[model samples]
Target chain A: MENIILTSSPTTPYFPEVSFDIDKGICEIRGESYMEETYKFYLPLINWIKDYIKLIKKPLVLDIKLIYLNTSSTKCVLDILEILKDYEDDSGQVKVNWYYDKSDPDMIDEVEDFEAESGIKIELKEF
Target chain B: MTSKTILSYKGPFYIELISVFGTNIRNFNDTYSNARKKLFKIFIELSQNVSNYSENFHMVNNVQRIGVGELFLKELDTAYCFTTINQVKRTDAEILAERCEIVNASDQMKLRELKREQRLNSPGEKFGARIGLIQAVMLSKNQLEYKVENINENFSYFSLTVKIDKY
Candidate 1:
């Protein structure tokens, strides 16, 4: 499968930067994500993971460095983590590292909530 | 309690305006303020709540529905009050008030749980308001303050305010 990349731009600040590399098994979503059409943006990322698991069967590392996420986009993040959790449960190798600004404690709480909801071990990194 | 007004706007809450307002709110807060994170989150959730569900809305190019509302950011002695007001059907106002009551009654943990439960659903016309309220309470660690002012038999002005404590 081909890789996907969406760079964040100041002109369109509603969406975040998304990079899903199929070969390297490293995917990253950074910046703020509160797009009005959240599903249109996130569903394909979900489907890409499904395809990677089915076709490549390789280890995956997901990096999330989001500062702001609306509730709807928050759900999409959970969905992505759920897919990873399922992959890990099936004896596949996957790891998630979430980066946050040191000044923001709420992101820490949010990552904790994601862990509680998806039952995935997400390492927190401060930037 | 008296509050110092920081910013205020009244008009259609279209997508472009929301983005501009969101950035303006962020720029208004200090980079080192511990309250910045919660303040921004509450601002986005509540404004988006109005932009999505407020009854008085206009169609943009006959495709997009942009809600008309007023948003205010005010500084209290110990907190920042982020509020939005908009016209809503009388029926929807009751629903909004009930949701506020539910959110205010829940503590942080419960609010988080409620937010998660409501957030699992997909995004659409039904996705924003309830979950946004829960997230606002969860982020701010404060009870929601709201009002429903009757404008007519079928419509009322719904105002929702949340306080983010400044540390």
Candidate 2:
């Protein structure tokens, strides 16, 4: 599968920078995410992940370092995590790491919520 | 709470304008830095609610879809209040009221649960408003106060308010 790479901006509809390498099995989602058309932006990344798990079956590392994400974007993130969780449950080599602002308690809670909802072990790294 | 209006605007909430508003709010009152992020988050949630779900929208140069609404930020001694108003269909008003009830009745933990439930309901906004409502309340840590002003037989103005207490 081709890698998905997109850069974010200092503007509205803050689409996060994404780099999903199918070969390397390293997917990193960074920056802010708050756009009106959230599904359109995330569906491909979600699909890329699914296809990787189904086809590649390599060691997958998903790095998420988003600073600000709206509720809609949050749902899409959870969906991505759920897909990874499934792959991990099946004894696939998968790891999820979330880097966050240590000073921002809200984001910490958000990362925890992602863990609780998806039943995934998201390693939290302080930024 | 004794508060005065720190910022106010009324017009079509295009994405560009929303970006400017966010920057201004982030730098609104540096003394309230603790509340800036929460304020910014709640503001984005509420304003996006207007830009996305307001029943009434117009075209910009026949190229862009613009949702018209009003936003106001009030600064008090202990908290900051944000209010938004937009036109909506009567049917939407009913749904908004129901969603508000769900958000208002829930505590922080329950609100978080509700948010997750609603989020899983749809990846395409079948329950988008529900998620946004729950999130605004959760981030603000305040009640979702609302009022419906009747405009005509089929439309009404939906006003929503949330307060972010200063830390």
TM-score of each candidate structure, all chains considered together = 0.92, 0.92
Q: Among these predicted structures, which one has the highest DockQ?
A: 1
What i-RMS does every model get? 2.7, 2.4
After the best TM-score superposition of candidate 2, give how far the Cα of residue B62 lies from its true spot, in angstroms.
Answer: 5.8
C-alpha positional error of residue B167 in candidate 1 after TM-score superposition, expressed in Å: 2.2
Model 1 chain A is weakest, by summed lDDT over 10 consecutive residues, at A34-43
lDDT digits (tens) for residues B1-167 of candidate 2: 57789889998888778777887888756676758888888888889889887778878789667789999999899988999999999888998998899889989989878876776666453334247778788888889899999899999999999989988
lDDT of 2 by residue, A61-125 (tens): 99998888988888788888888888889999888999998767899888888898899999999
Q: Give the TM-score of candidate 1.
A: 0.92
Q: What DockQ, between 0 and 1, does each candidate earn?
A: 0.50, 0.48
lDDT of 1 by residue, B1-167 (tens): 77799889998887677887778777764652667667877787778777877888888899888888999988878878888999999998888888889888888878877866776654533363247778777777888899999998999999888888876
Q: Ten-residue segment with the worst summed lDDT in candidate 1 chain B?
A: B121-130
lDDT of each candidate versus the true structure: 0.83, 0.84
The numbered model that scores best in lDDT is: 2
